[model samples]
Target: MIGKARGQEGREGAAGVLPAHGMTHYPAAFYHMTHLFYQSGPPLYAGNICTGRSGTAIISLMGETQGRVLLVTSGKELLMEMTPSMSGRGMELVCVPTLKYAADRLAAGDCPTLVVDFGWLPPSERGALLELHKQFPKTQLFTLESVASMAPAVPSPLRRLSWPLPMGFADQVRVIAKPVIILADQVLFSTGAVQNAFQQAGVQAESLEFGAELPDFIRRQSEARAASARTQKPKKGWSLLGGDEEPEQEAAAAIGNLVVAQFTGSAAQAGALDAAVRAVAPEAVCYLVSGVDTQRYAMQSLKEGQPVALPREQAGRIAGIMAESAEGGETRLKQRERERILLLDNFKPALTALSQALIGHGYEVTSSMDGAEALRLTTKGSFHLAVVGTAITMAELSGAELAQKMRERDPDMRIIFMVDQYPLKAALQGVSQVVELGLDDAILKPVEASRLIFSVEKALERRFLLLENARLLKETQEQKNQLELVNGFQKKFFATVAHDVKSPLTAILGYAEVLTGKLKAMPSEGRYAANIQTSAKTLNVLISDLVDLAAMESGKLRVEIGTLNLLAVMNDVYERVKIAATNRKLNMTLEVPPVLPPLAGDDARVGQVVQNLCTNAIQYTKEGGKITIKAELKPDRVEVSVIDTGIGISKEDLPRVWERFFQTKEAMGMRKAGFGLGLKIAREIVQRHGGEMGIESELGVGSRFFFHIPLNGPPPTEGAAGAAPAAAPKPAPPSGLPPAPRPPQQPQPPPQNPHLPPQPPQRK
Candidate 1:
């Protein structure tokens, strides 16, 4: 329960309010459950005091006050050493040996917001995360690593339930580190043919070289562990934060003093890695050597203040001089402040607000009137972030090209496309271009400043962090076979959790129907049957989510990714969602693409998302007047959107929609037919393929659901061999993974509250 107190300083020293909902209380015994480990190298948070070589992570916990912390350490020794300040907070640490163990503990009815140090997750344990989600629905899970490395962006039953624990200025840093994904791969060969191709391109790459060595000093101390039984422990039980024991200061001190890091691959990769390291710490030097005597020279040289050695025989006539890679011609950061933006006609507020926001956030801002000015400054000045005023543009620089140019110049600037509207299909296409052009971020127009700021910072910080952290990768030549094996195991394990959660739901629904029929005969079981059916619906939704995720990963969809018109896609979506619209008595409107461009993607999944959004709009509208689908064509992409004059979503639930099994505040107490998977599956489909999907809502008025996709996309290809095939007949040979479109598992209904008002039902 230790967190920012009322009137306490938050980020930027702003005061934060204390628990308004009355924070959950933890039993005193919970603190007695584990040994303590506190670590201080670079202050985990500022003002705590940091020594040694490490970075900073200002915000510590997830947004909400985490009720309890579950630490995954190897043993008490690690615990005592890592947490030296245990006595100050009177905090209790519970050590679960493995990710699975901690996941199981959380699922087995423990309800503490957990802080999992994923560093201990064995390189082999891929599915532990999915397994954990199945059992613990209420527990909000945060990975020490970013969500992407969770592998496949697979939808768990509790998709909305996860947040990240970032240690530094990482956006996903609240969770996974991208380097972990690179390291998670098993060993590959040094002279792999794949690596030679990269080398030919003048891109540094290597499958393997020599195993990196531990620092000489730490090496000598750990020799005894090698001499003793080398226990290949189960990933489930190796929690370093073991059972409750007294904090050990000596161990904490040792953990603090010694630094453990790894480097792998070949000289070229090492050299590139050196570039990465210097990106953060300009003066630091990097030495790459094999496991033999050469590496010893590098180590001894460090200790004795001598120069690093280069072994000519092994390194193949070494290039003597190597320093940080050049940052090229880019010098000063780009600034845009207080200027007229002429591109956008209808979204003037969005443009003006963005400029004001950038200035407020301490950036000098200027508005580009059109694509020409945007292109001019994109190349001329060193701008940190760009807000494209309109979705459509005409001039020398296309919106996507402008973003690309910024990347080419600095490779660190942030670019956001201010889109007005879009179709689900077209939005997915735009997202790919953002990734391809290496732009930082994008936002749909008419966004809140809070939301806009989030994208801006995320985009700006992500570029630099990716550059700096790329070097921190363990850099092994991970074997393809091993990686596949791990991914497969995860795929199967998630399949199992999804199935297991579904079983009880199926049984309950079955029994409820039986009882409902019997109630017609006895009249007594009707109430119980209703309750059972309600619970069954919720569980069913969870199952669907799992199944949808599995399908996407296995690429079981019928259509391959391709470029298609947003207006055309919108027409298709309207046809599908018409029934839902009719039942709700809502009118539909269209504001469409004029000379629409083709969006690159699978048409079917995008259609499914549109249908889901439309259905949601229909259900929420009060005998609704109108719902509109708008498609706006940008320079290099299209925006597809569903606009509805329906009851708007609460701010609390806006973020929850894209999450698995999440329900709106109004729907929480009803026997809703669908589980919370509609939005969850929609988002997974959008973001899984590297697009962004979100909703903007104002309570009681209306909601605008929109997304952007690129006009260019790689052609789709074959589905994975042996995976479930899509329902459609086999198409011509595919060029890429044929991702599936179905929800993996059915989502469950939200937990109903008795005091809430009854939900109004639309006509069937």
Candidate 2:
């Protein structure tokens, strides 16, 4: 019974014992019991319990975790001291002495946590640490310092932990559960502590200690996976088309497990390892561990952040935190999905680095190393924004010059400039230049990825706003054009209706006049006939005004130019309106120079203009008021005025007298028979004859309405002679009025060809 109890105690000890530094120094009895457990018992490690030594049925216990922690330090003594504490808490420690080795490890897969001992890192490598997060964004970075030199006022991404780790401080380390293949020096694997720890954590472990053998091993694995995939038969119904021949297949290489390697001191050998892994098994996860002497290096600089410390006792808690963080973690900077960016630079290294940084942040980036090539790309492709390097040296175009050319192609394209710090004059001018060139922003040299991203987002937002505004403006213009088109169509419809009504109206007026003559013997019947004739004539005048207004609106009013006798036109107008004036109890007179200069004008249209002015004067003048029609010859034109003692227009209403359908309150109360289009139509006719009309009036006294006819007549296009002038028809006398006698005139000259220009007046 005593021996059996002792055996049970040994088994329990082996099962619960933590793997740590100097773990090889166990009692002989403990080793014997461990051997026994390994040979014939339930698998002690987390690796394949069913497949045993073959490790074929490997299952990852930590597959839920996405990435691992990378420890970078050159302090061998510190590492040796921390190894035991880390191992005691079941944490996995992989240290790389240099930044290059750290990069290799991170590039292999995702890294959620990074711990760097800044105090022990070489001075030459300190600056590179500032940009480490850009290259590996998934990492949650921390730095160890010997002194608190950085100000707490400035915020930084790095979590700073003081050196000479505190007694109770702790840090989290990621656990690897998948099968691991280690490539390192033979001394590292000699003790088998790493293998044992991995096995305990359910991670299958193997080793190839020589760096020279990695390429061959990778090549063999790739060939074996390819052969296995190719040998497999296709499943039934794999091809959409039924055929005897096999369908084309893509041979997918199998990535079996993770790899942990320690590279040699030679950089070339390390580069070879990276190339071999990428070429043969691109999907394989790898960790490159390197070592250096901390005694030779010194810390020369510090970075900004809040100071913290990790304690040994709380190591287990830190591990749990790391596991939680890695499960589903986000980077410090937010990702911008699917926004295309054009990056221009002449320096290859800077261009490549920035390109990677932007790509990691979820931006679709197109980079150009030459300015000319960048311009070509910009012309061919559409981009939301462009980041230009102002100090370009490789191509014919500088950064600003290239941006200007791009702006010419796309006026609304958003641009940001990356300017150098040297040349103080240029740097100082950058702000004004940004505003002048309409650039979005200008960032100094060595711009941080975060700041650049913020600027880019702002620029893109502005671009979106501008595009939206332009779209709205275009829509408004389209609506305005549509409204104008509708108005034009309505005017054309009015003209057509007015023209159609004139033919029927003329017949009504002619029949009414005849009826009046026939019913002269009966007083009552004659009165009715006269009323019908008067109403028809008023309707005819309104229709004529409507037609003229529509024609003027549509730019179709016609005036046939000819040599005019001013005396004949004035006499015609006087004869037509004098009887109406006498009936209204207003005295009308006409005064003109008998031998006035021959004017180039349309005789009938000019007669109509004079007649309209006289009619308005007669209608608006009070009883016993005087109306005088006067004509005077000026140096370049003839002035015709109608002076009346009438209810005149107010100053406020004078300017609006020529507007169609506009009427004053006094005019509406005095007469509701007209549509207020007469003055507007008359003014248009006078203008078409190369003339202008205006009115001078006072509210209570009198009004003088006048117009000017240029001696040259209307422009050639407006008043070109199309046909001979039609003779003016005589009006029937009104009821109970004598016939208007014609004024005697001198013998008229022979008519000239209608198409010929007006001849000079003959001096008699």
User: What RMSD, rounded to one decimal, does every model reach?
Assistant: 32.1, 27.8
Name the 10 consecutive residues with the lowest summed lDDT in model 1.
317-326
Task: Report lDDT per candidate.
Answer: 0.46, 0.59
Give a tens-digit lDDT track for model 2, residues 337-359: 24668888767667766765665
**lDDT of candidate model 1 versus the reference:** 0.46
Best model number under lDDT: 2
Q: How many backbone clashes does candidate 1 have?
A: 87
Error of 1 at 562 (Å): 3.6
